[model samples]
Each structure stands twice: as C-alpha cells, then as structure tokens.
Target: MSRLPAVFATGLILALAGGAAAVQRLPATPEPARLTGWPQPAEMPGFGDDGTLGPAEISDLTEYVLALAGAQRDEAAVIRAVPLYQTHCAACHGLGGEGAEILGTPDLTRRQFRVVTGPADIRLQIWHGDDGRGPMREAQRRSGRPHG
Candidate 1:
C-alpha cells in the first residue's frame, strides 16, 4: 500500500474529530421571546377604528374583507358581505378589490399598503377613508356610510 492513502486517511480523521469537538463546544441557542400583544400600530391614535359594527360583526366582516383581499377564508362571511362590498367598496376598490390607481385607491388584495397593516388598519380605513380627512370623508358621509 502507498503511504499516500495512510496520510489522507489520517488527515480526514483529524478533520472529522476537530469538527466534532468544535460542535460540542458551541453554545446552545436560546429560544426567542414570545410576543404578548398586537403590534403597537394597531393601538395608535386614529388607527384602531373598529367602526360601527359590533364585535361579532367586526370579526365576521374582517374575515370576509381579508378573504376578499386573498389573505383569509370564510366563505359564509364572504357571501354575507358581498352585497355590502358591492354597494360600498366596489365603486372605487373594484369588484375584486383590486383598487383604482387613478382614483388613488390602494389595492386591498395586498396584505399591507401605506397605513393599512392588517384588519384593524382596514377597519380604520373603512370607517375613516384613506387619510381620515377631505373628499373621501365627504363621499362616505354623503353615501350614508359610517365616517368616523
């Protein structure tokens, strides 16, 4: 047998032993801290508007809205809210909630856009329109939709 084989085998054994020892000496990673509450933005002023809907209604409608946005699923809720969306949202938001860029409406299908972060932010937008001020507010008020 050539001495080359023996040298290669010794080097491989030493490398394996060194790697194992290094791994054994490594510190254990600690578990990440658990979060206790909703994100701070949801609780900020002028952002957490739950609107005129009752808690149950809000929850159900939120499920429906998120579903329309392609973020969630609740067939019953979607069915129930279809007419409401058609009446109130489809005008500017588009029938599929794709939004109208020329009209400055943000696409609802996306999970986040501008001030809208989640359901709470969506609720605020639904209640207050885009900026909680100006023409959209007047339009919502004139249309008899909740504008707070």
Candidate 2:
C-alpha cells in the first residue's frame, strides 16, 4: 500500500509539472498593463514631437518602449509591424529581414529574440545596458544569427 501511494503521488506531481510546462509554452499575448499613478511620458520633454516623427519611426519607438513578451515580429504581430519595418527598419535589418550581423543588428524572428520575461527585467535593461548595446543583443548574438 505504501509503495502504491508513493507511486501515485509521483505520477500526480509529474502530471502537474507537465501541465505547467504546457501553460508556459502557450503563445504570449502583449497588452499595456496599467500601474497606479505612473507619470505620463507625454508630459515629459524630448518626446512626442506632434507628428514630426514618421509613422515607421513611431512604430519602432513604440516597440522599443512596450517591453512585452514574445516581442518578435511574428505572423500575428507582423501583419501590424511589417509595414512599419519596411519603412523604417528594413535598411538596417535588410531586404530579407535578415538583421545586420556585421553592424550589430537584431534579428526579430522569434518570440524570444530578447527575453523580457517580466516588467522588472525589461525596465532594468532599458535603463541600463542590454547585455551590450541594444535590445536582444544576447539572444541574437548567441543564437549565431538564425532566422529572426
């Protein structure tokens, strides 16, 4: 009886862990999360140029600040982002969307192009250094420039 109970408990634990892993594997959704009394960027200087910046620039700028998970330009997200990249990012990333390894460009091919796993991590990176210079530097650099 003791052996049976121990085996049952182990199986239950394994099942739960598998379920948790499946949950983690699910596609990530990006949305603006609100915080209490956070100051507005609009009110600050050196931002919001009253439409002086081009639309593509606006998109890149937004992507830079959003700090969301799976921030890559996926099929779902690409529908909205490709036009933006074509106008702004293509020059650096290239016509095939292959980022410039020669000039430290980032490949936005996957959900993990850069891991922002949480708000705190993303904030620290944005304010400080991103493994080196730009966002997703570690992931992109380490991956050996795979498609993304």
Candidate 3:
C-alpha cells in the first residue's frame, strides 16, 4: 500500500511491457529496400564501385587531373574550386584544410599527408575514402561530379 512500492511495481511492469513490445516489433531478418531512383553502380573514372584502383590507373588519372588543373591555373580556377571545396570538403577538412582532429581528418595544408603524397594521392583519397576512416563515397555518388 506504500507509495514507494506502488511506484516501483509500476516501473517494473512498464519495463517488462516495453521489453515485450520491443521483442514483438523486431524482425527475424532485416531486408533493406532498394533505392530505385539512385544511380546504378558504375565504374567511376579512377575507381570502381567496390573502391578498387590499380596503381597505374590511379597514376594516369592523377596526371590527367593535375594537367587539367595546371592548365586552368588562374584566379578563376581558384575562385571556382573554393565554393566546391567548401561544399564538399570543409565539413571534415576545415575552412583552410586545417582538418578536424576529432574526426581523424588530415590537415590538407600540411607538406606531408597521412595517406596522400601529391595531387594524385589526394584525388585517390577523395574518390575512395580510407576504409577504416569516414566515407565520401555517399557524397560523391550523390553529387554526380566526375572524380579524378
């Protein structure tokens, strides 16, 4: 009859009821729905859907992209890249490529990188995110931008 015992009993009953409801709601096996509207998996410029890229392929692609970048080396190119970088890279890389230490994002402005050594390396990293690290694959897939 005490208020304390009554409250305790009510809590125990609610917890057991909630547990039963949770168990009932759980599926025996999860089957995720396919997103028909999304792009069908296709081989990207420098990589594949499975995120594989040979050294030769990566080198060729890197050279091509760097050449293009070099050709467009001007104020206009920098201006264009700024917005794209902000939209895609800023969340993890920071406004000035300083990187988010908490997220394990490397400082882009540094002379040496944890995973990348040059322009080609940067492209590879951007295209195929480090397996143990975070992902840009979803961003790349959604953006539909051609990757180097």
lDDT of 3 by residue, 4-72 (tens): 998999999999999999999989897765545543422222243345554444444334334333432
| TM-score sort, best first | 1, 3, 2
Please give the lDDT score at residue 115 for candidate 3.
41
**Number of colliding residue pairs in model 2:** 3
> Highest TM-score, which number?
1
lDDT of 2 by residue, 1-148 (tens): 3699889999999999999999998779855555435433111111113333443444443454341224443344345544654654466556544565544444534323345554333323322333344344434455442211
Tell me the tens digit of each residue's lDDT in model 1 across 1-148: 6899999999999999999999998779956544344222121122114444444444555676699667657788778777767765677668887876655565767643564445665554555444434223434356554433
What TM-score would each prediction reach against the true structure?
0.47, 0.30, 0.40
Segments in model 3 whose C-alpha atoms lie over 4 Å from true places: 1-75, 133-147
Candidate 2: regions farther than 4 A off: 1-77, 110-115, 118-132, 135-148
- Superposition-based RMSD of candidate 1 using all C-alpha atoms, in angstroms: 14.3
TM-score winner between candidates 2 and 3 = 3
Clashing pairs in 1: none
Candidate 3 clash figure, as a count: 0
